[model samples]
Target: MNGIRAFGATPSDLALDPFDEGTSSYSKAKDTSPIARLQERIDRGETKLSHDAQFGYLLSLMEELGVSTHSQLLVFSKTSLQRERITPKTPRALYFNDDVYLGFIPGAPFIEVSGMDSKLGGVFYSIDQGKTGRPRFVRTDQCLECHTSTKTLGVPGPLVRSFITDADGVVDMASGTSLVNHRTPLSERWGGWYVTGTHGAQTHRGNLSGREAFALHEKEPNHLGNQMDLRRFFDVSRYPAATSDIVALMTLEHQAHMQNFLTRLNQDSTSALRQFGHLNMKK
Candidate 1:
């Protein structure tokens, strides 16, 4: 099969301005997002976080948000901004709720996060995992490079990328790629995640590694089984949870795509309101 060219070959990708704060809603009111409010809670001692290890802070945040450790899902793909820390053996752990997504890489300096805003749809943030002073929740704009693009319909949003990966978790774009969502077929899902649930006899592209790029097989949902033990993959002690529950992965896929749609809607309404004001002033 012909290897598809790089994603950056497209004109829109070449023209992408990730730091163009001029148009992003985040640049305008980042300080008002839910993440920002969470920081305020920290300041008031309403939410306490340990300034020690990343896990401590992660655990605290999860507790505050009602996210269970049981909801853990591991992704070995280098599909995030902190690609350097991802690998097949040490996958990034993801936890989510109806309104937020929390990402933690084993040895990364910070935890990548996003929370839904009533106005902005999805707001990006990074909490310093190594902070000695007050833990800083910095609003990040770099995420827009991937979150705001044709893939997301040109707004800040969540997206899931499915592709064949090498041993180190680097995607082999030449093989193939799929923009996954809840609607995506189960067989075409979870290319680089460790799914730990039984789905009858169904099979998926999870929990496998090879020396070279290889296409995923057609996995019947019945072949997949619910797995609660993940000690075989890595030391379960290092993480807060052991199971990479398949149910959580399925929920993540659904919410991620929904978040993208919400973001675009927010941006559209904001733009339209501005246009209406300009036309009214002319009358």
Candidate 2:
């Protein structure tokens, strides 16, 4: 419950420069991510990605990266970098494996992607969906603005957030948002998302896409609980899967932060060893 990040009360957090070349070297590090590896294969002509008329480059990219289509999860919150086109009717689809997360907006020009780096924690990239001879995953820095924060353990990492959203998928700032992980209670999870499955009595904030639903959550929180189908929320035909699985969502929430924790530990240990020299502890 108490930590250096909670209030910045300790100078310890400032001890390591995450971007320093000699330390973590987040920006300078040659990230050995799966996306980067796949890109190399394409550049060397060792492999080529398929682009389809129906799904664009989605299926091919997923195949190249080894991400399962069944791991798809839907988030309707308008808190994305590409928020202008996202809505409850056009929620963002995220498919992931243990090492990577790929985000797709139905009509967007490109697919957003992030993958784990042994040194950089999370490396962000994008793949264009338009017709082209060769597709490339361009690494970007803009994603770091939000991806690196106390919530991500001061590392460039992925996050699964929960917020109070309105009908058009706009988040209500007054309602406050939460950085979710496994530590988060089940009842408080999944706002601004569509979760399809059946839970007899348990409740979450998923499938509530109205201002009134947020307020009603104070009383009848389960007003939208246990939705076995998502046909009414959006066109199920538009996405890879009709169901935004609860198991996948929960696993994603936990995995995202577990990566951050690993990065934090790696960063701090590297920095501390360099700064204070080796420990002479009493074994």
Candidate 3:
């Protein structure tokens, strides 16, 4: 797993394992990510993870990850590993803390997680909800397909996108999309997400469903904006939270880019310092 994690899909990608001896080895180093630490505790018999009848490891995982249930954001776009399971009727729920992010779909077998390492940019894993007695987080690189691209500033990092989504929860890629962040305009954010709040007359692309509704948005911007309830679109009772807080969504947008920039800084500085030291040693 360590060796596989060291190498990325493309040659131009940085060797996360620390190619030169001078730099710290990210894969081989003391992995201090939240999930990794929790795994260590489990291995040492210090603690155990629990499961639930309905939410599976969701409740337990959030406790272990130290994220608030209040931080949940609901995204309905077909933009995840379980695309078939996600629709406007069943939007995927996302929760994040400063360093960790947990993604869940109701009744799904596993909970997707992305966490930050003090050194390694982002680590991806999934906890099997079915494993009752001894659930373990299994690391996977499948997330790198989208996470390590230009959107993440060429490093393994967070991804937040807003785009036009039709009724079936399909994102219209050709219509253009914004990789959301603090710089994102109010009008362009939360296209595929369910934002439940009253933002006064400040219009956004949230809560509007179907092509017709979107067409209406082009004419009347706030027609579907400032939605305080989501029961009409889907059974809000089915999700962890009845409402997706606009403040939480806004915070997520800012932090996503911040995490990417922080990761890029960590990578670049480490490499540069290592090379400088290497050159000095030869002198």
The TM-score values for the models, in the order shown, are: 0.81, 0.90, 0.87
Top candidate (lDDT): 2
| Model 3 stretches with alpha carbons more than 4 Å out | 1-30, 278-283
Prediction 2 TM-score vs. true: 0.90
What lDDT score goes with residue 123 in model 1? 76
What is the TM-score (0 to 1) of candidate 1?
0.81
lDDT of 2 by residue, 197-220 (tens): 877788888999886777787788
Q: Model 3: C-alpha RMSD to truth?
A: 5.4
Candidate order by decreasing TM-score: 2, 3, 1
Put down candidate 1 lDDT per residue, 1-283, tens digits, no spaces: 1112222233234233332453353677654556777788888988677644547478878877777887788889888888888998889998888887789887788888887876665678898777556777788878877877766645566777777677788887764445777777776777777878777656567765554324233333333235557777677777888878878888888887777666555555555566565776888
Q: Which is the better candidate, 1 or 3, if ranked by lDDT?
A: 3
Query: lDDT score, residue 69, model 3?
Result: 89
Superposed by TM-score, candidate 2 places the C-alpha of residue 96 at a distance from the truth, in angstroms, of: 0.7
Pairs of residues at least 3 apart in sequence or in different chains that clash in candidate 3: none
Q: After superposing candidate 1, which stretches have Cα over 4 Å from the reference?
A: 1-24, 51-54, 211-228, 276-283
On residues 136-219, what C-alpha lDDT tens digit does candidate 3 reach at each position?
888887877787766776667789888788898898887545577788888888888999888988888887768899889889
Candidate-wise lDDT, in order:
0.70, 0.82, 0.79
